[model samples]
Target: MSKSESALALPSRRALFKSRLNNRTLMRQVIARQESRRSRNLSDAAELPPFAVRVLTRMGFGPRRTELAPQSAPNPNQVFSDQFQRSPLLGKDDVAYFESLGRNDDERLERYVDEQLYGNLPDPEWEQRKAAYPASFDTLDEPLSTTYSERECQGFSNYVVPQRQVERAAFARACYSRRQLLELIVDFWHNHFNVFSGGDEDIYVSWAHWDRAVIREHAFGNFHDLVQATAKHPAMLHYLDNYANEAGGFNENYARELFELHTLGAINYLGNTSPLDAPLLAANPYSGLNDPLLDALNISDPARDIQSHYTDNDVYEAAKALTGWRYDDEDIRDENNVCTSGGTGAFFVNEADHDSGGKVILSGGLQNIPADRGALEDGEVAIKLAVYHPGTARYIALKLCQRLIADEPPESVIQAAADTFYANRTEPDQIARTLRTILLSDEFKDPANWGKKIKRPFEYAVSAMRAAQCDYTWRFDDRDTDNFLRTYEGTGQRLYWWRTPDGYADDRAAWMGSTTLVQNWRTVDWLLDENDDSDADRVMRIIDTTLENFPGNPTPRELVAFWCHWILGFTPSGGWVGDVGTYYAHEPTALGRACMQFITQQDFNGEEDSPPFPADQQIPREELRNDDWPNRWHRRLRGMVKLILWSPNFMQR
Candidate 1:
């Protein structure tokens, strides 16, 4: 067998099932190791790192190496050049680009924020890379039924081709795109207005449209526009059972989540109370003004009073208003039993199924829908009322802050972002302005707040690949890529696979568990491994840490230092650098011995370490001075890279 084949082999089904028996013991060991790392980071917290490092890792999927200018440049005495030479792993071009924006950290941060928010930076490389994956982008305009039939005719038994293609493209963008802020915001919105792309055949087949048209288009656009688009999309309609909602048989699934998760959030949820009992607020100026519905209701000064909090009665009324909103499919019909729309995959209101009776919503408010209004008007008004609520602004702002800053961000920043969101409700760049408020706030640049957040599984995986300069092809049929994704699922944060509408938890407590930690470590190994059974030249290697790229023969200590600086971006504490370097000097063959030593010696509940290095068989560093050392230690060096990625320093933002 080839080296890749041996390294990438999978266990049998029975063996995999039997492995579950040991999960309890494995969980304990992972917990202990995490505690040790946490303590060490707290102890070593003194001086703050550079702002560039923080921005690259937290805002984007970490940094990649950049081409350096010649030492004989016009301005060779520039201080950045000296810093770049000292830390060769740092992306010199990236840092220089940020530095050119302003003279200091705060100024540079503001410039960078505006550039990203306005999308002033063009990434031709990402566009060119994305162009290669036509299959991922071309099916967005196709109907779900047509796409499903075509896939079946093409010998695909499953109807998930579009979803898989989208997943591949998303991964590629996260790893390669220079529009880093846009990509991150897109991810945040996808999680916020999440739909299970793999749940149903229609959703699976039309997943491309949901991603491209609904989410990406409105990622930095108005929040109200995004919510309305999500409410009408077929993926969300099917996922939340809104397609079946009608006049006689109302489905409250979409309505409940719209209020609880999407719009006003649970913070404004006053359960099982009369709508009239909720606090009264001033009416939204944009809604209920000169409306035919409210006019027909014969309510004087209908826009005078509005309810602050929503009750169960309000949800029921919202469901009534939202009835008959569905995509253009074969089943849509009018009261005359004639087909109104079909096979278009566009949203349409079925008048036959719509509830047009007179109803009062937000009860003290004059936002009432009179009987016999137009088909789509009621739903539009209802959505406007929810989107314009004060609670919606605060809820969405808090979520954005939680994603970009800390889990529990400072109230000052949240209020500032919320004000921006509310004030710019009618602006095209509402979301962009809100993000600017958060990113440029003093709370964001505070030294004490740095590294307070932990990287999620998606962030960790993409950042590791990016830091190592992984050559990702994003081809759906590649064996190694397939293996990497399957292993990534174990981390429990698979993209678009979140079961509930609330989405994946963003706080540290949700992801700090032992299962998540161990699974993330396993994903690191998968990334470092070579493609199984393929020739070195034929295979698209994920990572290449072999010394063949080095200019000259280097000692074990130097090798350790290079990777540590490359992956962690800053020097780590807790004797990690010295311990790993010493272990490499003593045993060159067992490159990850020191890492395993740290894991085990820290009282990690006696878990058995892998690729076992014998304690008695130590090879001195001088023994590896031959010309063939690079080829001999290529795989072992990858093991060391895995160790660095698994370290706690890499986990922090």
Candidate 2:
């Protein structure tokens, strides 16, 4: 039979079921290994592997497989050299620039950080791949008014399509983008200023605009600009109930989150304390009540100083400042009944609905907004005050440090980053400057800080795909893509689907649950499956195990080493190589024998057979000369790869 025909030979349903059962057993073993590793990591002396391994896994996804040439007889010695030459998936110029960074770790990291921060590098391959998505998705780039009228309210039939397109595009970018640091920063900003796309129909239709205009545009720009853009965006307006905020009725949803979650953080929240009684810094002590209303209230505290902490009064006043800020909706109308709001889905102040009242914000009467300030000036001042506050700077810096360094980063790094953030609050590249300070800090490069964080589900899935060199066609209509997304959702990190304003948790404790781990294993299993038995070309294959990819009859030890370098970015010590090689070589363990029977379609009895080969021993060349060896080896290799992906090493950042 032809090689292709042999590869496509169908297995019986019973056989498939048994294979799945065996996979479950293998998964359990991997989970046990993970638990042991976790215990070790908690120890004071736990050390990470290497610099490249840690940084690549943390800063980007993981080490990607470089495209290899088809060889008649692949030499293992040449594989390491060729892998770093170029990546077929990334732009040639981009790969060249990356390689040109430096020879050593410090030089490479310094150059790479600057390049990513400035975003001067071009990724033609990524751009071309993104352009291949359906042109209908281009409408997402239009203004919210256009999207709302033409797509959400009028012409387009499906409101969910825009959100789906955004989600798919995000996954594609995470998996393939050459500008990995920019992508990582964009993700950080998204979660920081999160607005759930699934919660409101208006948000669903304008989700693309929100992602592009608010998050991606200002990802590395000024934090002040990002916050202002988010405050005015239709998605945020609707998601936070700011759209419903009006004169007589105040909605504190957006305003409260503006303080607690967005800017100052809940760490700065001081509940129900009268502004007059709140404490102030010794450097900036209270002078006198600035607003007449505060004087009229007869609340007096000479010890009270310039607002060091926000009170419940702050949330109330901030809500009043944002009272007139809302998007133009279809329901809005004018005195002449001419749809004066334009149904544009853009931000506009409704003069009639504005509170138009003087407001005292923060304790000790700092930032007093005068009565009847028109054209949304009140809201603008409020946003500026909140975003520029010392607490805001510290809060943002702490979060950034947590994301880039460790879960609980050193106080010295946080203070340094916060100082950078506050110093350049007005610069266009303020965020970039702050990030540079953090990335180049001693804490970031310290080996003790490495492997202290766990990969969230989204990171795990994307890193796996990148490492495996999966041929992912990220089209909405492709069944494999759809199935992949569906299975990924089971791990509980569905993109843009976090219902809460806090977004997904970044702490390790939140994701180390038993259910999440098992679901992740199952997801990897699905990724490596040959979904179509009759058509080998239609399979959802992650890696190709033929001679072209792994030329010659390599011993099981060599095969395990190659994949470990490819996936884990390092070869692990201990008897891991021997144990996995034993499984691939079909040695005499119970699971190994079952896997062998499944792949070779032949049973072996330990009682009747002679002594089994040692785990480190290589499989004989004669046994590899069978007509169906390529097909059988492909099946066996898939199992071994799955185990590697499921390993504790792969689970770390």
Candidate 3:
């Protein structure tokens, strides 16, 4: 029997035929592994080292090639905690992009983050960096070369002009940011309060400000502050048509969402109390509540009479309080484009249009807030009320857990995080501390929940690029940038383009459709190709580095195993060494074949076997030339890379 036949260990000897070199051994092995994995079906997730792998994959993007430590499988909790305490660092591509700016080094935000741990600027530095960006960002940061005084830049509500600097920067950071957890949360928050920039020209201007001045600023801060920032931003005002809201009319858009989507969440009608059936409320059976739909949607509030649950009345009341909030530029463009005391990020109030009449809110408990001048204090009071509402804490906490842990997060985990959020209500890092509690919990580290959340489009692309250590280059053409950006859009979760108010969903079913699932992979060709060609050299270099960094020159098993874990975050079942061994030998240098043979544990007795099959099936062996061999083998490597990336194993988080 041939060496290949012996290695497979087939039950019957009938399959042991001639050792012809054109074998589909590797392909067969892949098929076998797929079948084996189906039967195992994550049965191996909780095992020691695999458990470690599952933790990293779930917590952040799967680890980079150099990050795998099979020798010392670290505890998942320690890894989770360690990431939070460290400061954000610059990534390799970030360093490269900054270096290319020769004289602008001091002005780069990349340097600021590296040296100062935050992205604040003296003035010119921030604007210079913005201007240096590709034109795709212009909609967000137009007048890029010009500088804005700190006071002027503060919520300066200009007109609707959408730009994507934040989206572009976000894409780069996710691919290369050292602060992994922060980036992950930033994305979560953005989606939580989505404003479709494509709605109008106004959103372009408003979203850019919101993305930078608001979302990025408050991402790690208090949940209240985040709620406040979004509540008053012109983008949200315009997205929800609150700008047109006046005494004569009302726009329930922003206010309704503020209670239903942003703060209390759709299902959470109870403001700050647990359900009647909750452990804390076990003593109370019929907690005093007077509303039906509110109670029907949310459990009966134990503190019901004390903390009133919301009703349709609350949405309109909040909207009444928010009257006169609109973009200063659009609101009074004829007035030399002047805005409020605050600029773009600010929600300039048109007092003349304000509902100045004093009124009561919720008509219940402390929830009943007093009215104010031109409804000014009303807006502030409305935001404060919603964010501090107990339901807000639970809603935000549960969503955070869902994003960081599982789709169906355990009640214990949700309650624990909610408790932390409520306890540190005013701390700037309240969200940070709350996340720490959930991330460290056993629920997050549990391997059974490893693949619950699938990667979104931007997340998947950036992470894949980072894993491969991909060198991202851009064509000078704006068209190229648009094409590049379209790949992100292809996943149906494009940033700043969610037309509806609720934004992108964390639910797996939203992105995981029959055709949409494959679109993410189909566009990878552009990401991998250099200058848009089919050459595989860039991938080859990355692979070589991955191979060389190991304890020893890895055989095919060692090489493929490392990537399977590094890229897919799980080890392959039934092993893949033998087929890779056959692939390498088809047309390889003596050294390469030797490495493959070693990985496969094949006997290399220095005796020649039959020559490999011809490269083209159409031509007989006699017609083929020796020179064609190199091309065949290179093609093999491409196949291996694609199979690893496109397989079902890599698709799940």
Cα miss at 351, model 2 (Å)? Answer: 1.4
Residue-wise C-alpha lDDT for candidate 1, range 463-545, written one tens digit per residue: 88777766656656667668778999999998899988888889876777767878887787676665522335312232233
What digit string (tens of lDDT, one per residue) describes model 3 on residues 130-170?
A: 45665535544433212122223334233332344556666
What ranking of all candidate models by TM-score puts the best one first?
A: 2, 1, 3
Candidate-wise lDDT, in order:
0.66, 0.67, 0.53
lDDT string for model 2 (60-176, tens) is 776665543222232334332222224343332232234444565676577677766774666665577767765535655777676666556432345566777778877778777
Off by over 4 Å in 1: 1-31, 35-48, 66-93, 133-158, 282-303, 331-342, 365-367, 532-549, 571-632
Best by TM-score: 2
lDDT head-to-head 1 vs 3, winner: 1
Better of 1 and 2 by lDDT: 2
Best-matching candidate per lDDT: 2
Candidate 2 yields a Cα-based lDDT of 0.67
lDDT of 3 at 272: 40
Q: Which stretches of candidate 3 lie over 4 Å from their true place?
A: 1-52, 66-162, 270-305, 330-345, 363-367, 473-480, 530-559, 569-631
Worst 10 residues of 2 by lDDT: 1-10
